[model samples]
Target: MRLLAFALLSLWACGCAPALSTFQPAHVADKGHVQAELGLDVSVPTGAIASVVDAGVVLANIAESRELTEGERLTLFEAGGALALNPPSVTPHIGVGYTALDRWELNLRYTGSALRLGTRYQLLKRAKHGVDLTAGAGVGRYVIDLPVGSILGLVELEDFTRWQIDLPIQIGTAGTWYRVWGGPRLMFTTFDTALVVDLPAFTGYPGERELASFSGTGLYVGGQAGVALGYKHVFLGFELTLAEIFSSGELAVLGERAVAVDLDSFIIYPSIGLMLEF
Candidate 1:
């Protein structure tokens, strides 16, 4: 079950990217105007995260301490054991932006179990041949639940709940119907888990032992590029973003004995959406 703890912590540490948001316009919308959008995002692992996910088959075999043929290991990993931490990655998101005053914009976005609120100020409007400049900040929070199965018949394994916060600063350009933006982002994450094990039954120890919680925080920096195309009030666009966890606090697990935590540090994604403005 120590392997189980390692797997779960790895999942939490690697899964820190905030759910995706669509690219925003550099210039605020016309006063009294509103824009609504719906999209799908796909997260692609990079750096250490990518390496670990790519070696899922080997990791699964190692955790189970089983002898597996190459084909068997590949099949097992694809069937969703340790691979559960990586694939089938897609989520839906929705966002809205409202123009409050001449150069001020208010926005809200939602993806999975996460929500975000933000504001943007147009620092420089686009001229006949000049790009627009804007700066904005946003805050987001996410909650995720992962279920681990029953163990030993003496106790049942429960779900792990992950909570996270994201703060981002964006600076970029806006065009009549297209925009490109990039910036820095910060994140904090914590998790709660209830692990009940009958120590006397297995380890010859006294009674039941439980591990209640774990947490970690990190700083990440990333950038994004996107373009929109449309006519009148309807538009379509795609965006690509890349981010890396540059530094992180250690993950601490509380139980009979604490477990060590090591996490991968990179995330990348692409998103596409449709928007209607009025």
Candidate 2:
């Protein structure tokens, strides 16, 4: 039991955990086998953040002298300072995995500004019955650099960073040519960054300028559903994930020159991938 616990801890420390898409089956690859994957993930904003993104786009258009209907202008004002903030829309990743020992798979993946290393341990495998189960943990660091100039003004950020840790349990069935899996996950993420918003000088609407940094930590509970189809040595997969964040700290800038932007929101990540096994 102690050895198992130690192994799990070491895996978590490795920092590459399965993400929203676990294209692999719960069955670990044969010992010494290797797998390679390439995928794309797109984040679709929903709830409050979605509203802010829409309003921000409108504000950007107005800055470029694009006229808006009265309703659109209303939305821009309604979104408030939150509109000034921009989040990532799309990211792509490449992953490689190796089975160092029987029933254990270690993974390494790179997605833009982030790199992750993780491991999965197969707990149950019933090939005849087409059932399998596995669990894993992951930790990762990200450098988030979104140019403040493109958006409208008073937060200045240099080398903003985010940290994330997640735990996931996957269960699924696999046949000779296909696999299906879905499972639950818990993710904790934290970040520190600044924002820049500039109201048009021509409009003379004094854009709020507050020189402050934003920092917050939040927990997300979510699940993923995925399907994979493959030939002898290759597979194609797709996954859709939904998660709602519960915050531990208020997402805001510090000090008297403070800006408060709510970071609590619901989000969706959809991904597609091609995998090759050897």
Candidate 3:
């Protein structure tokens, strides 16, 4: 009976998003056991999509300071390499855990857009080279709907929905293969959106029609660390998370009056997993 293979990196973030799930916070999966996992989640955006790729490298330095034509300077260096080489957003993760009584544990996760269910409580329990603690709470739903020329077709990101709440705390140590953890996570998010902007004849105005609406609230403060190894059933885990994304908003249009937005950002999440326990 040496199977507390801690691996609960089920972290999350919203406001440029995702925890990508790679959690380890003290053990669970003993009483009536059941654990399953699969993962790969990565999100790296150093704030506002890296300032929109540094404003596309400052519009390729303003198309090399005025005087265009060369197909508009190759469409401004291909829209500044599509916003400065945008990359680092990968998702795919799955999780399942159940403990039922005796320390309680229940979790379900997914990371395509978002889907989560959580429960954990094992508040310190590990002796013999001890250290264990766990805490949890979760709720999620994040979706971004964009269609109708989303960028080349001409700007659209109509309707975005986000509703999340998570509070996690974990501290760890485990053996019989190996496991280590770290924690501190808190996320509370809310969102609403609508946008359809068109105007890009090299900003020569007159491409009218601009509608905007945004409603937001976000707070994410994070910390996570992880490690895991395998043996009696298969395990492998790795996690790292760092966060800061404070947001506030109210921006309206379509007959104006409603403005206030203060968006702050920072994020770096990484996860990797492979687990099975029965």
Candidate 4:
């Protein structure tokens, strides 16, 4: 009985004893494996920043922020030429942008900014191949130029507000290190016009005669796709998207007579970007 107890104690000590973190052992499984990841994405100029941050916050919130926060994050996690994604994770993004005048009376020619927050949740927590999905939201703003032929003040220009929502469907490959993701975006926009010369605070037009005022709004839809290249300590990837915006608004100019102006336009823009995981 004493010999058996000694044998059991030795086995326990050997099995439970921890190894030095930097130490790597030779194994059929390769002594390298990643447990978590963080990614930064930039491509779409206007809303990229907000989108990335949103994704990252989500991943952090759900999975307890495994991303190295040491003020510097990792970009990829790889092993045997594949990625490492245990179950739950977070991804963040940021970007900048510029708009320009086009075929419409209401054209834009200015810079804008963006960001995002996102996260992934695993449905089957213990399986090597599981179903994980992600979601994020963000906001952006830009300045637009009007065809009224004046550029002196803010009144001659309009304000364009944009909102973003992202949803990603991710699936782990069968007994592999790669995961696939795809989703569509629902975007919203509002164009606000200002009164030139601060017309009486609430007066609708530039003059007391109340000739006309212009305004507009647009809605856009688009899709994006990407793959997560996971390494044991980092991740690397990229994505591309194409979006089309449709808008219409009313405009009026008056001195003594009343005339009506209608403005309509369609805008198409495409973007591409890269991401690093830490």
Top-scoring candidate (lDDT): 3
**What would the TM-score be for candidate 3 when compared with the true structure?**
0.33
Q: Per-residue alpha-carbon lDDT of model 4 for 29-82, expressed as tens digits? A: 112221222223222212322232233333323223232331111111000000
lDDT of each: 0.53, 0.60, 0.61, 0.27
Weakest ten-residue segment in model 1 by summed lDDT: 76-85
Quote the lDDT for 40 in model 3: 79
Q: Each candidate's TM vs. the true structure?
A: 0.66, 0.75, 0.33, 0.37
Residue lDDT tens for model 3, 108-197: 887666678888888787874378887888887755432122432333455566778888888887777877888876888777656554
Instruction: Write model 2 residue lDDT over 169-223, tens digit each, in one string.
Output: 8888776688678898688877655543343444544434333445667677888
Which of candidates 2 and 4 reaches a greater lDDT?
2
Winner on lDDT between 2 and 3 is 3
Using lDDT, rank the candidates from best to worst: 3, 2, 1, 4
- Across 1-278, the per-residue lDDT of candidate 1 in tens digits comes to 54464354444333333564446655567888987888877766556544444454344434344344544333322222212322224667888989899778888987765677888777776663266666676666554543224332222334544444555445566545655556554555444334433223223333434333323444555766677787757778787777665432232224333333344457677888886778
Between candidates 3 and 4, the one scoring higher on lDDT is: 3
Provide the lDDT at 88 for model 4: 10
TM-score result, candidate 4 = 0.37
- Score candidate 4 by lDDT: 0.27
